[model samples]
Target chain A: MKRARIRWHILVFLTPAVLVYTAVMMFPLFNTLRLALYTRIDQERVFVGLDNFRTLFFDPIWADQFWNALGNNFWFFVIHMLVQNPIGIALAALLSHPRLRFAVLYRSAIFIPTILSFVIVGFAWKLILSPIWGIAPDMLDWIGLKSLYAPWLGKEEYALTTLALVSVWQFVGIPMMLIYAALITIPDEILEAGEVDGITGLSAFWKIKLPLILPSIGIISILTFVGNFNAFDLIYAAQGALAGPDYSTDILGTFMYRTFFGFQLQLGDPHMGSAIASGMFIVILIGVCIYLFGIQTRMRRYQM
Target chain B: MNKARANPYNTAAMHGALILYTLIALFPVFVIIINSFKDRRSIFREPLALPNSESFSLIGYETVFTQGDFFLYFQNSMIVTVASLFFVLLFGAMAAFALAEYRFKGNLLMGLYLALGIMIPIRIGTVAILDMMVATGLVNTLWALILVYTAQGLPLAIFILSEFMRQVSDDLKNAARIDGLSEYAIFLKLVLPLVRPAMATVAVFNMIPIWNDLWFPLILAPAEETKTLTLGSQVFIGQFVTDWNAVLSALSMAILPVLTLYVIFSRQLIRGITSGAVK
Candidate 1:
């Protein structure tokens, strides 16, 4: 009887969170997946199991857009992995130096962009790179690299990559901070041991600190993967829902938003929108699973 | 430590790289803010120049204030963000406390269930979420955004708070229990105060995303009265794109509040993140 009374309090504590999370998050997510498996016909819901999936994959019109978006999404992820993570790691490594002057100032300033809304970053970059505004051209001329100036955000070949770089600029702070945190936790004794063994300076970083921080790197990688795939606001704010320069910048998020919400001439299609979202879900799940099972489990966490 | 003394060149190079990156990060924001104070022609003629008495103008800010429902949007954003933060911290702490303090059946399962949102982006359910909101007549309401944000924030809140709750000394809680304090009182008086730093960390983490979120606000609360600062700024800038002064000022207005808050709380925010509350 006493134990039963005790258990009641547990339910009391858990109820509100469980109720809210389920109603708003889990239920809607599962419902979306369910919606994807069905389609509307004659203003009534109709079961169309895997037909949406088949149309998305095999049908030429849908297939082209889906593949384009998916490919662009992968490139977006690749840029973050290759560009953002390395720069972030490098910045963290530099900032973590014990005698570095103005380390806090540098860290704080670099992270300033991260806290601003995507709207600000997107529009700010847009204005800076605007051909009419002449900032980019002027800056290039100042540096005597005027020949390199182009309206990158307006060019089909360069729009996606340019936006990806902008995103990297805003977000590199995350990995930098995370890695810096990890780097600071390393026992000074370990580095001293490496120093005593004639492994100091860059060599000490490479041979000792680098290996110790691999787990942090892995965490940063997965975060980049998840964040990149789900990214919408930057592209939407900068490129519009059409994700143009001829849809070159259309990642899954923008693609799904356009498909669901409708834009210009296109009418909304919730079923197909859910299908795209479901596709994103699978992609993110695969990436996360690979990290969790394939990478995280294998990486040996040091006791220190 | 001696590496600094031994390698002056290396130290200089590190500082050089960091300084260059910091400048790059701040350049655009600085440009926007400065030009917002300048007249339109001068903004284009000398975008990099600081606003002097000759260039200074408040025309753009006047336009933003008069033309758009900017204050309403700010209020809506504040309401949604603050209300959501309250529920997320309260309910999340309660749930986290239950998991940390009790060894109940399905505890791990419940914890994992709550944690699913941490890895899975909640935006996947936009289609259904929109439909449900419409069904419940919540579309275009601040409550819709608040509820969605609360759900979105809870998983991470529980995850971080649970870690902190586990570190709260058990003896204190037991002694409180012996004094005839109920579980709720023990939670309110004992555990919650101990986990305040973690709560602040969770608040800092959730606050930015909620404040700056465009997706939910755009989708659920796009009505004129219900728009958030982010969506409002986006729409305002879109309409006034060619009006350079107004555009720059609108962008500046949006940036200033978040910038000020970030500057003030940056120490606590950095400490929270570096304290490994996330990992």
Candidate 2:
């Protein structure tokens, strides 16, 4: 009886969180994959096996959008990897320097945008870049570069890239903070030894600090990958679910949303939407699996 | 250390790079807040300049309040965020305690299962979540949002709280046990207090995402009564796209509360991250 009573405490403590998470999170995730395998016929869900998958892949209508969104998503991830991570690393390196004046102030300032809602960041950037307002143009004109100013958000050629950069601007602080934490964790004795060996400044960063923080960087990269692929709020906020200017910025998240919820002309298709979501799940799963099996193992070995 | 102080040229260059990056970081926010306070003409005419008495006006704010139910939206946001944070912290702490303090069956499996949500976003489950909400008649209700967000926040909260909970002193717990305190009492009185800072850190980490989330609010509960500040602002700005005054004002309204919270809690937030709590 006492053993049973003691066990009840664990159950009492664990039940609420586990129940809620399973009901709302895990069950739904699996259910979505199940839903993807079935399609509606005369308002009833009928198991269609891989029919939906075939339609999604071979049907030009769906294939074009799927591939386009997938490609755009890749580009978005690439931009963050290339631009945001490097910039974040540089800022973190600089800020982590011992005796840097006003480090806290700079960190707070740089991180402010990260805390702002996607709605605010999106609209603020949209307005600033609007050609009619001439704010971006005027700022450019000050440096005699007004000719370079264009309605980047309104053009198919530049909309996705433009939005990607905006997202990078907002979220660079995360990598900076994470990498900063990693940098500070390095022992002072090791750095002192490096200094004794004449490794300081830029070379010191490349030779010593960079290698030690590789695990953190790997984590950040996976985070960036998951975040970019899962991204929708920024695009939806900035350009609507259509991800407009000819749907140049539509990624998997937006595509899934539009498919599930339906936009102006499109009817909501739960089955197909689930398929796209499952597609996204697979893509993310592949990325994560690769990281887990490939990158994480190698990184652990190097760290050891 | 000597290398840093010995070179004035290097110091100047470092300062210059930092200042340049800082400007790039802050310029947009500065432009938005400053322009939100200016009259329509000056907002466009002098977007770069700070408002003087000649150009300053509350017309934009007046329009925002009159046209939108911003106060109600703020209240909704407050309720949802606070309620979600409470549940996340409480439930997360309990679960963390169970995992960290006990040698239980399926503990590792459960931990892995919960941590999966951290990597695989809850957004992917929207189709079924919405379907379930609709089936249960929870769609278009704030409860839908609150529930989903609680679920969304639990994984990270559990992970971080458990890490902190593991560090709690076994000696103190044993002493409490010997003093005839119940396990529940020990957790509430001792372990809970010990992990308070971590709980604060978890709350801070989760707060911004919950408060600033546009997707779930848009998907789950976009009804007027259920609209959060982020969604309300998004919808309002979308409608008033051409109305620069209203648009800018609405955007500022969204920014101010979050910025205020961030400024207030930034020390805890920064310390929480830099203290290796997350790592």
Stretches of candidate 1 off by over 4 Å are A1-6, B3-6
Clashing pairs in 2: none
Candidate 2 per-residue lDDT, tens place, A1-304, comes to 1355457889989999999999999999999999999999998989999899999998999999999999999999999999999999999999888888888889999999899989999988999999988889998999999899999999999999999999999999999999999998888888888889988889999999999999889989999999999999999999999999898999999999999899999999999999999999999999999999899988842342
lDDT of each structure? 0.94, 0.92
Report clash pairs, candidate 1.
none
TM-score of chain A of each: 0.98, 0.97
- For residues B113-170, write the lDDT of model 2, one tens digit per residue: 8899988999889999999999999998888989999999999999999999999989
Q: What is the lDDT of residue A247 in candidate 1?
A: 96
State the DockQ of every prediction. Answer: 0.89, 0.86
TM-score of 2: 0.98
What's the C-alpha lDDT at position A50 in model 2?
A: 89
Model 1 earns a TM-score of 0.99
Candidate 1 residue-wise lDDT, B1-279, digit = tens: 654345878878888898899999999999999999999889989999999999999999999999988899899989999999999999999999999999988999999999999999999999999999999999999999999999999999999999989999989999998999999999998889999999999999999999999999999989999999999999999999999999999999999889888988899899998999989
Instruction: Report the Cα lDDT for residue A261, model 2.
Output: 93
